[model samples]
Target: MTTRARASTMAVPAQRRLQSWIKQSRGYLFIAPAVIFLLVVMVYPLANVFVTSFTQIDTRERTQEYVGLDNYAALLDDSTLWNSVRNTVIFTAASVVLHLLIGGVLALLLNEQWLSAEVRNFTRGVLILPWLFSTAASALIWGLLYHPFGTLNYLLMSSGLASEPVEFLGDRALALMSLVLVNVWKTFPFYMVMILGGLQSIPVELYEVSRVDGAGRLQRFRHITLPMMRPVILAISTIDIITTFGHFDLVKLMTFGGPIRSTETIAYYVWQTGFRDVNFGYGAAISVMMVVVLSIGVLVYLRMFTAREQMYGETTTAL
Candidate 1:
């Protein structure tokens, strides 16, 4: 090739390389802020927690003393920690199930065509009040309602619905359940809103076609509404389970894990260990365990949702 032609070819490659570099640099420039923010806000704190979990740090310590896995070992032998785990699981399970059931029912009720638009809107607005209130405020309000001589008990007594006032929050057997009820009351509205939004997005023609085919209400719900709402249900269930599992405010304010630690959730246990007992190292370990458990739950939820979507596709193809 001629010398000039060779020079032109080399220049073309150089120009292409420069253009590629510019594009790559622009991409990194767009992402750099988010990367820095996450490192500062999330990565650094998580790293500190991980480091602290392996040390014996407390109020008295200027520097954390490396204790290896002793904190984790102690947790294994701690009966109170086990009890907290059990309570956390129970609370999470009960709250998530009840929230889904109640919220699904409420969504169905509101989705009814016979309901006036204005009345439905008003009811939805009122339903969100519980969720709008602060968690501390909700806990306080519910705590009063659960009081032996509180308005709920008084009304029940006056109406002859109860033989006597029920010791809702004070009894060991009832404390966790009572907390679950309060949690459900405060959070189910959120699920209702999500499911209602999904319900609204569903094409009305499907329901109309089902009706024309002599499908009853139950049949329509089973075949149409439930199938269409599956994705939303899975999403909401995942969020509700995680939130309920880590719930601290309601349990802290209402029972303080009281009635003999009956409502001591994992989150509250972490708080107690870290702040109240000033055992920051052990608390960090527990927090790490919580992160693992919650991470597993979230992964499982995602897998389940994926499987459901695949099965739904197969069913649709089969039909």
Candidate 2:
């Protein structure tokens, strides 16, 4: 090759390298703020929680004493901890299932073009009001409604459904169920919103095509709607599970784990152990266990979901 041609070829590579460097530098510059923010806000606190979970640190203890795995061992023997685990599982599963079912139904109804847009929008607004309200305020309102002489009881008695007012929150049997109902009510709107978004993204042509092919409403939903909505449903269900599992405020305000420890979820148990019982080390252990449990659940969800998604392609019909 001529000297000039060789020089031109070498220069072209250098120019490309320079462009690559500039692109990488710009990408790093854009992400640097977010990386630093997460490290400071999320990573630091999470690291602290992890470190604390291994030590004996209480209010009276001025310094953390390294206790190795003793806290974890103690957790294994703690009946209250196990009870909290059971309750947490129950609460999470029940709330998530109910939320998905109710939300899916509502989303389907709202997505129907035959329904008036004004009516759909109004219902959406009304449903979302619960989610917009402060958790503490909502809990208090629900607590009042569950009172012996409360609106719910009054309505039940007036409707001849009950001879007397039922002690909804005070009764151990009823308290957990009542809290579950309240949680389902509070979170269903979130699922509804998510599912509605998924439904809106689905093409109208797909539904019309299904109908033209002699598919009934239920068949269309089973075949077309569900397949399209799977990813969104899985995403929402995972979020619902995590949120319901870790929930504390509503339960604390409504029943405070009730007459019995029936409603005591892991989150409340952690607070009670740490702040109430002043056993910081035990509470930290509980927190660690909660994290571990949630992590496992998330892993299982991802594995199962990914496998399902692969087995049945993204748009494969459920029917």
Candidate 3:
């Protein structure tokens, strides 16, 4: 029972460990390609942007010099950056709120017991058409509608609502709201479809039981429907916030951040700064700032979700 016996015992365990490692490595092989792809496409570009943000780039000379936080510092005094930020917040908040309100109501109506299946299906299909169009396509269609010779102006003039063709996309005050309306129109259908799926997943028995207890439609909705749909609502709202906050294509196409840059969002500003103005370093800084803002927003939403759950728990306990 000396060195020979001890060495044999250790070798058996080491051999077993090797076999286990080999077994786990085989599973890792399947995911290795996906991991590499993400690193190449998403991670590398993200890291490059972060690096670029710290440097001053000369497009003419194809060179970069480390400038530390100068790019970010410059943003502090830039009135245009602040303006874009304010516009981005307004556009995102308005669009998300309207999407939720309109989508929720539409979902409830479509899920009504009195609605025939054919009518519901037809209405749903028609409503979802807006969401089917690509952003570029939506911009084109809305562009036509907002033009001086467009149907909207025609109707306003014919109905005596205006003495002239109202510049829907031309007026600075109306441009931002015009974009918001277009965004809401194009995106609410997605929220509606998501809420409808959540509604349908809810067990019918819950409604029956509530009705038997003399709960009215409003009561049932407050007690049962809302609680059940919370997850879907939270998910879709988070997505809407993130996407809407960084929205660019519509603004680019419809307004070009124009009317004295009234409709400029941070996203469009990044483009205007980088490609348009050839300030790649400053644009990268803006992009990094946007990521930070989006991260903070997601964290705040998650925090609210947690607090809501805790509040519900406390309420139940009290009840």
Find the candidate with the highest TM-score and give its number: 3
Report the lDDT of model 1 for residue 153. 95
lDDT of 2 by residue, 224-314 (tens): 8888899888888888787888999887888787678989999999999888887787788888889889989988987788788888766
Candidate 3 error regions (>4 Å): 1-17, 314-319
Candidate lDDT (C-alpha), each = 0.89, 0.86, 0.93
Strongest candidate by lDDT: 3
Candidate 2 lDDT score at position 23 = 88
Residue-wise C-alpha lDDT for candidate 3, range 279-309, written one tens digit per residue: 9999999999999988998889867886896
| Candidate 1 off by > 4 Å | 1-19, 314-319
lDDT of 1 by residue, 1-319 (tens): 9999999999998999999999889989999999999999999999998999999974665777999999999988989989999999999999999999999899988988799999999999999889898889888898889899899999999999999989899899999999999888988899999999989998999989999999998998889988888878877888787777888998778888998999899999999999899899999999998899889988987777778778778232211
Q: Once all C-alphas are superposed, what RMSD does model 1 give against the true structure? A: 3.5
Which wins on lDDT, candidate 1 or candidate 3? 3
Instruction: Order the candidate numbers by TM-score, best to worst.
Output: 3, 1, 2
TM-score of each: 0.90, 0.89, 0.92
Candidate 1 colliding pairs: none
Instruction: Give Cα distance to truth, residue 70, candidate 2, Å.
Output: 0.2
